[model samples]
Target: MGVTLTDSAAKHVANFLQKRGKGIGLRLGVRTSGCSGMAYKLEFVDEVNEDDLIFETSGVKVVVDAKSLPYLEGMELDFAREGLNEGFKFNNPNVKDQCGCGESFNV
Candidate 1:
């Protein structure tokens, strides 16, 4: 399995890209930091690297570098709103634990 986006996430990303007018897609990755030892990184890509792996879902492009593919495979990105708060949520099957602040995870 590869990366996927929820309908809400796809819509949100598409709208943002429309306003920005330059992005080719969204890039997802992981970095070594945070309390749980790893944290998610998200960015809009204007260009994709030749080695990048690309996945498409719900009309949105999800790009991941080869190095990050193992960590992010099978992940579902979602847009969520909870009362006064709203943001992107990651449903990562590889994750084994998450920090209390919800900013990082261990796999």
Candidate 2:
């Protein structure tokens, strides 16, 4: 399976793109960092690489590089608000464990 965005996530990204006015979509990737060795990276894409894999959910396009596909496949992106905190959350099936601080994961 490929990456997907929950309705809330799609709506949030759509709103951001609308506000920014120059994005093609959102980019999802992983970086080598943090205690658990891997961390998620997200950004708005104004331009896409030719090799990027594009998936659409709720009318929003999500772009991911081929190198990140194995790590991010089947992941579900969500947006949530918890009291005073709010942000994007990753529901990654590939994650075996996460660090205690909740900053990174091992897959």
Candidate 3:
């Protein structure tokens, strides 16, 4: 399994890319930080890297570096609006525990 994006997520990304007019896709990765020791990082990719694993979902490419694949595999990204708050949400199966603020996780 690999990373995926919900319809809402794909649409949101596509709209952003269109306005920015220079991105190849979205990049997902991990970093060593946060209380749970791991945090998710997302960025707009202008080019693909040789070691990156690319997953296409709903016509949008989600790129992950080789090192982050193990942790991000099978994850589904979603865009949601709840009352006054709205943003991307990660549904990660590999996560075992998450911090109170929901910004980091342990696997």
Give Cα distance to truth, residue 8, candidate 2, Å: 0.4
Q: lDDT (CA) for every model shown?
A: 0.94, 0.95, 0.96
RMSD of each: 0.7, 0.6, 0.5
Worst 10 residues of 1 by lDDT: 54-63
Off by over 4 Å in 2: none
List the candidate 3 regions with Cα displacement exceeding 4 Å.
none
TM-score of each: 0.97, 0.97, 0.98
CA displacement after TM-score superposition, residue 15 of candidate 3 (Å)? 0.2
Query: Largest lDDT belongs to which candidate?
Result: 3
lDDT (Cα, tens digit) per residue for candidate 2, span 1-107: 79999999999999999998889999999999999999999999999998899999999999999999999999999999999999999999999999998889989
What order do you get sorting by lDDT, best first?
Answer: 3, 2, 1
What digit string (tens of lDDT, one per residue) describes model 3 on residues 1-107?
99999999999999999999989899999999899999999999999999999999889999999999999989999999999999999999999999999999989
How many clashes does each candidate structure show, in the order listed? Answer: 0, 0, 0
Q: TM-score of model 3 relative to the true fold?
A: 0.98
